[model samples]
Target: MPEINSRQKTAIAAGQKVLNSVNGTPKCLVFTSPAAAAWAQNDTLAAGQKIPAGSRILSNCAVSCGALGASVTFDLGLRHFVTGAEVDLDGIASNVASATAGTYAANNGVLVAGGVDSVTTVDTEPVLTLEAANPTDDIQIRVEIWYLPPG
Candidate 1:
């Protein structure tokens, strides 16, 4: 699975810390398809990381991508960070498609201790799966997750 990701910019880090008050930080996963037929490369991004046990999701998960073409949909999920087990297939969102270029998000309010399952017994990693048609232009996808540590 692809573990390469970026941390949210510092501009929001302080605000996020204040909101969670538990050392919450943001995780941004990105995938870029430089040309047609490259989207299939997403298979390599399956089972990416989410969070550690005892962590909490402090904000709604956000996904942004352009409308490469029609019938492009996505599945954002979370799996056990340590065990690499499937946790929530749609932990972020499901059937996310946009007819026009725009952003899509899932209103998954604050996740209790231990992340989405609230078990606090497992870790997590954000997984991104997409269904798309070949587009002549390049495209990129980004996943944003706000979560606190396993305190």
Candidate 2:
């Protein structure tokens, strides 16, 4: 249940509810770290792997690295947060070459010989453009977020 402030209770007793109706308020908040103890999801995801679009990823009250690095290419569609969820693309498309971690990096920072990183200019919504690499390499990616109903 949603918590009602004291003011709301007083208003209710006085017959002066703000919206004149009692319903849960639709709300949103961005999180960079993990959620509280109860915010954990029971599902478990493997590390440095590409999770198919429909698979569910969750945080376990601790900011554990969800997906590793993956290439967000035009052919594969932009990594989506899917309506009704919050996704954190901390190392989206990061390239860890020999470390077994790879991502889409557009020739920036220390990138894997054939890998690149996905870029995003905005939070909540991420738009990634993967760079093409030689025949010898592959891309990797990881995304972190909480699912929520789209507003």
Candidate 3:
């Protein structure tokens, strides 16, 4: 599925526009970051927008921002792109803000890696992180990404 690019691989880079494998359907990751938290710290990995190990994190992605006041702003990033430490701080989304009450879109310039944007090599959980300076109380959001599970 990666025939058009120069850095193509043999494992196949699945996508909606490109060839979609049977297990390469779009997977939605929804997470909510409450107030006073710069990032998403879920009690369990299943609670947030956590991507499974050996998954292909294709391009088609989105994030919905909840009420966080007009002056509120945040950055949507990734955590544990590598195991143990938090990497790719602003890899998922960056320089995004929120409204008092409505849905907003997130900006993801370089997710995982710029070339293909797939989390194929890593075997750790990749969770979406909503970072803010003073994250207004009761802020919420949902991040959606289309990915292919490890085959």
Q: Which candidate is the best by TM-score?
A: 1
Off by over 4 Å in 2: 1-127, 131-136
Q: Any idea what lDDT model 1 has? A: 0.55
Model 3 regions more than 4 Å off: 1-23, 34-50, 81-84, 112-117, 126-133
Give the per-residue lDDT digits (tens) of candidate 2, residues 1-151. 9976775578778997543112233222223312322211221122222333322122111122223224212111123344413344223332322222333222222211134322222223432222232211222333332222222
Per-candidate TM equals 0.59, 0.18, 0.58
Model 3: per-residue lDDT, tens digit, 6-104?
Answer: 323433444323333224566765655554444332221213335656666655566665565544554545555445455454555555565456654
> When superposed on Cα atoms, how far off is each prediction in RMSD?
11.4, 15.9, 6.6
Each model's number of backbone clashes?
7, 24, 0
Best by lDDT: 1
Q: Comparing candidate 1 with candidate 3, which one achieves the higher TM-score?
A: 1
Model 2 residue 29 lDDT?
A: 23
Cα deviation of 114, candidate 3, in Å: 7.5
Q: Give the residue spans of candidate 1 off by over 4 A.
A: 1-37, 41-50, 108-120, 132-137
lDDT-superior candidate, 1 or 2: 1
